[model samples]
Target: MIEERGRVLSVEPGAVWVETVRSSTCGNCAAKAGCGQELLQRLGSGGSRGFVRALTDRQWQVGDEVVIGVPEDALVRGALWVYMMPLLALFVVALSAQALGGSEPQVILAALAGLAFGFVLVRWHALRASRDPRLTPQVMGAAGFSGVPLTNL
Candidate 1:
């Protein structure tokens, strides 16, 4: 289980939203710095990220510590493919059309269109999946502690 501790912001019969605290270590990572994620992290005014998850055995209060898990299959199958396939498909379609079509500007435009299409497809799929009940994530377990409950100070 991919578990992180967060506080319950809301709860329903099937789900609870726990807000996870993202740490400075997020920006301190070498990969994040190189990827420009550090600058993106700095733009956030909040310390936590809210995750709406399906509830299992866990009892929750507004401030209770709850564990959230995004299944490995879901991570690999849903999130990974949703983004990766689009990009890969973009490049493949673009490069193949360029190589086979024999037109430079057309190839370039095809590639740009592919890239844009890939990004948009990922976002579209993500939104669609989140709205579907079959795709909802499961709850892991619960904890007693909240995040430093994710404070600005």
Candidate 2:
């Protein structure tokens, strides 16, 4: 399970709205000094808040800290859907355009079009996935406040 710490914003009948900060484990790496992620982290340190709708059977209150967990496989699948689809679409469309004897410039244009189309398809699929209960993250349990703080809410 991939776990994250978040603060409960509100509690509903079957779920809680949690506000989490954006953080990456790469922040603790010795090589983070030279990592692009570290640079982006520094750049994003203005502290943005992201909200999660976590399904849970436990009671929660405002300001209560919690640990939410999602399956690692789900995250991997989501990452592939968001990143790989456009790349594969570009290559496939470009090759198909070439097979049809399109000019070099036309092939490039076709690839660009394919990339855009893939993004649209991914966006629609993401919307559908968000409504699927099985895909949503779940509240694992309360978290202690003694851990290292990444960012403040």
Candidate 3:
């Protein structure tokens, strides 16, 4: 599980909205001085907060500190779906068009069309995956606790 500490922002039935600060390891990195990402991070607003609605069985109050988590496999699957599918679609369609003796402009248009189709498929998959509990983040436990699940609190 990938976990992060967050503060409860609001509560609804079976769910809590939590806000977590975005953090980076730049401060501890040995190559920070030579990294472009470190420079960009310095230029950008540091530690911006992101809000997420995490599923939970227990009631939580606003301002309560908690830990939230999602499974690592879910993240890997999501990354593949979001990145690989479009590129595969583009290549397959473009190559098919070329094999069929399509003109350069036609092959380019076909590749673009394939890429758009891939995005549409990804959107559909996301909508479906949003309802899958395995893909959703959950409130793991209250912050500062050790090895205790939130349901016990």
Candidate 4:
């Protein structure tokens, strides 16, 4: 589980909404230059974000440091989709080409097609994975370290 400190923006019967604090790692990511996510994070000229996650047990109030997570399993599953799919595609294409005596151009096209399809599938899966309730971070306790002072409601 990955943890980040966020401030609670709201609370309901079964969940809490938190405004996430932007991290330096986010700014350092190689894809930050082109991703819409980095652009959104840059909003407020570089400050916090409105990140809402549902919590099952725990009461939160405004100005609290609630920890959130990018669950381990979700991370692993997503990696396989993004990293393994293209390689599998390339392998399948190469084997099929050898069997059919296809031209080099045709074989390369198959690899490229696989790359495109893999990228699309990975992106889709990531979006869905993010919404899983079990994957979210929960409030452990309280701290007086920084940002908003922690509180319970």
Go through the candidates in order and give each one's C-alpha lDDT. 0.68, 0.88, 0.89, 0.68
Q: What are the runs in model 2 whose C-alpha is more than 4 Å off?
A: 43-47, 145-152
lDDT of 3 by residue, 44-103 (tens): 855677899999989899989899999999999999999998888888999999999999
Clashing pairs in 1: none
Better of 2 and 3 by lDDT: 3
C-alpha-based local distance difference test score of model 2:
0.88
Where model 1 places Cα greater than 4 Å from the true spot, the runs are 24-48, 51-53, 57-59, 131-135, 144-153
Clashes of 3: 0
Model 1: per-residue lDDT, tens digit, 1-153? 566666678887767877776555664466875665566667874354555666655566776666666666666777676668677867887888877975988887787788888888787788888887545665666664453533331
- How high is each candidate's TM-score? 0.66, 0.85, 0.88, 0.60
* Residue-pair clashes, model 4: 1
| Best model number under TM-score | 3
Q: Model 2: which ten-residue window has the lowest total lDDT?
A: 144-153
Candidate 2 matches the true fold with a TM-score of: 0.85
Candidate 4 wrongly placed segments (more than 4 Å): 25-54, 127-132, 144-153
**lDDT tens digits, residue span 39-98, model 4:** 766675455454766474767787766676666886776678879976786777667876
- Residue 128, model 1, lDDT: 82
Q: For model 1, state the Cα shift of residue 117 in Å.
A: 3.0
lDDT of 1: 0.68
Global lDDT of model 4: 0.68
